[model samples]
Target: MLKYKILWFLFNLKASLASYRHEVHELGFQKGKKHLKVERIGYLPQQVNESSGLVYLAQDSTLLTHNDSGGAPYIYQIDLSGKLLNTYPISQAKNVDWEDISADEQGNLYIGDIGNNSHQRRDLCIYQVNKKIDAVLQKIPIHYPEKQTVPDAEAMFVAQGSIYVFTKNLDKSGTDLFVRKIGDNADTLQFKSHINLRTPITGAAINPQKNKFVLISYGKIYYFRIIEHQIDFSNPLYCLNFPHKQTESIAFLDENVVIITNEQGEIYRVCEN
Candidate 1:
């Protein structure tokens, strides 16, 4: 057990160092006008060190998050002050690289088990959990059409009865948007569009009104305006410099306020300046 813990520590350290280097390199490109005001709020509980997904529950006024791959299959609920409120366990599902979580209007939460860093996973799927019952409603299997080498993705959002997944694009070329409608069985993801951001996308969140959404990378945040109920990737509403380290999750506190969290358990709140 001690050996495993040591390996985990070393792995985290290596990842942190890489992220720091990327952040440093991005400093030169972020010299323009900063559009968002970011403030450190608090540190999350030690148990949530690798928080990977974030979503705000307006009805309960709480935030729900979960860890990344290799962590237990549990969702941690927390308050705005970064205090752990509760832990909900999903016994029906396995934590095969769970990357992001999204919620629909019908009180159902979608846990994306879609992280494919090796680009060789064939068992990718999404778990739909009914919040009220605290149980998984269905397991939606996902497949990439006409592609054997699947791209990794860590960001997802559910909008207008469909799930939108944005690829991380391990090559740092850009991100591709894929969509799969909510259904009773498995389906193939349809490639929708692409954004030329030249960075890996870590997390994404749509506002309560569903008119806008934001994608977060290690050192940048890209905001898009939803036009005619669709994501408009052509012209971003705002491309702000985030300058954070290993940020993996983001959610909207409201239409204007966004909450971001990294693997180091630091919490940051971003708002338009």
Candidate 2:
């Protein structure tokens, strides 16, 4: 009798999930209805001109950022107000199109050097470092198994013991999401899914609970909820608008609040209304 009841419960749960996914697919991706007012909270020091990636370090109430390729292979530590605190140099890593940053539960950081603008580079990798700026840098190489043209990715986040990368939709066929185990051998990455965002993706951040994943473009932010270990991207709960044109980086200030940074070194915070 107990086994029968468990089977019935699982069946109902699967049915409900299918129903929800279908409903969202029908609704499609719509423009965010929430008009969030972006408040400029601080100005990044001139040293970080192109703040390509951002991650909020909750332990210290600070932010970690790094510039794009052609810049130093260093990460910048800043306060919530965008004031420069210190710079940690990664002597072993090259800035070859360093596009995004992510951190794990152990407070270790990962820098994605997976940006291939020209779509021809053969080498793609990520740099792992400690949060305290004292550990030795480690390099992990990754190859996209099914990609013919080199993939250009600017957004990445570590979740569920794996690191996921969101590729830029330069091909206009929507973005492809890739995932790989954090400690796995430096092997080819597996394709997770194709996110039909209908727009270019620049940055992304996952909330502390791993329940909400937010992706940002130039003018909008799309929110996705995690369901059964998969992202339900059908109908986003919120589509928040960003006032700036060059919003290249995003980090969650909290469960309901987010902070964005532009290429010109301006910081803005938007909260759910």
Candidate 3:
């Protein structure tokens, strides 16, 4: 049996890298949510934490804690509208080089802790919230994926009952996206494939239907349709970007729209026309 893989469909054209601008334009020839300005729940100045990676607008609210000067992109809980409800504290804050956060429909939240510099680290793993969440219980539990042999990647996507990882592919001409199913050393995930993104992808997310995907990077947002074969890295179907600090997470609120979150906890709602 052929191991089925997910691919994104591209629909638009042209590529120009220069200056940062914020404008909404529906690329013709093809098709495509909330109107409220993401009311600032509250913010920590950029100087607070020098580094930024992933932010899981985690489904659990009580698990969310407030800021601790110890480490990381401070974890927090916010309403769908982006209001700060609570924040989670980091106890040890060890190896939390978080790249992005992905959640299964079952409410299982996967935090991508693999952030590699120079692609040198050999040991990598994903932090699985092993603690079972009960409708009656209000505390957070900690769980982790066994271990992985895949290279460190800043991008992660939850799809087809597994997880997909992609690195920045920075300074190497076009981008390259790597795929791997989620598992551990005990029950390792099979290696899927490596894709040449040809685009600078900061982060990515799979839709609820798991039919399509969206990515944000290099100050632009791109969309893809799922295909049976490997992706063709030559062109993107549709792409757009705003003047933000390179987006990190792309969560789909619906088929025609999605949410792109920046490092500083800012979010953009893209509505296709």
Which candidate ranks first by TM-score, i.e. highest?
1
Q: Mark the 10 consecutive residues where model 2 has the least summed lDDT.
A: 14-23
What is candidate 2's lDDT per residue for 1-273, written digit by digit as tens? 347324533433333233223224643533344435568899998999989999998988999999987889989999978889999988878898888898989898999898877788888988888867756467888788865687878888888888898887654467788888978985688888776654467798999987888888765577877767785354366554454656779999788788899887899887766
What is the lDDT for 208 in model 2? 91
- What are the per-residue Cα lDDT tens digits for candidate 3 across 110-162? 66666664455544555555324212111112122334433446667666556
lDDT pick, better of 1 and 3: 1
TM-score, prediction 1: 0.87
Ten-residue segment with the worst summed lDDT in candidate 3? Answer: 4-13
Off-target runs (Cα >4 Å) in candidate 1 are: 1-33, 184-186
Query: On residues 1-273, what C-alpha lDDT tens digit does candidate 1 reach at each position?
Result: 447434533443344334323333442223213557888998888889789999999988888999999899999999987899998989999998999999998879999999987788999999999976379999999888788698889999998999999998756567899999998354999989886665678899999888889998776777887778877475467666665667889999898889999887899999876
> Candidate order by TM-score, highest to lowest?
1, 2, 3
Looking at candidate 3, what is the lDDT of residue 114?
64
Q: What's the TM-score of every candidate structure?
A: 0.87, 0.86, 0.63
Model 2 spans with C-alpha error above 4 angstroms: 1-37, 232-235
Local distance difference test scores for all models: 0.82, 0.77, 0.47
lDDT for position 192 in model 2: 82
lDDT of 1: 0.82
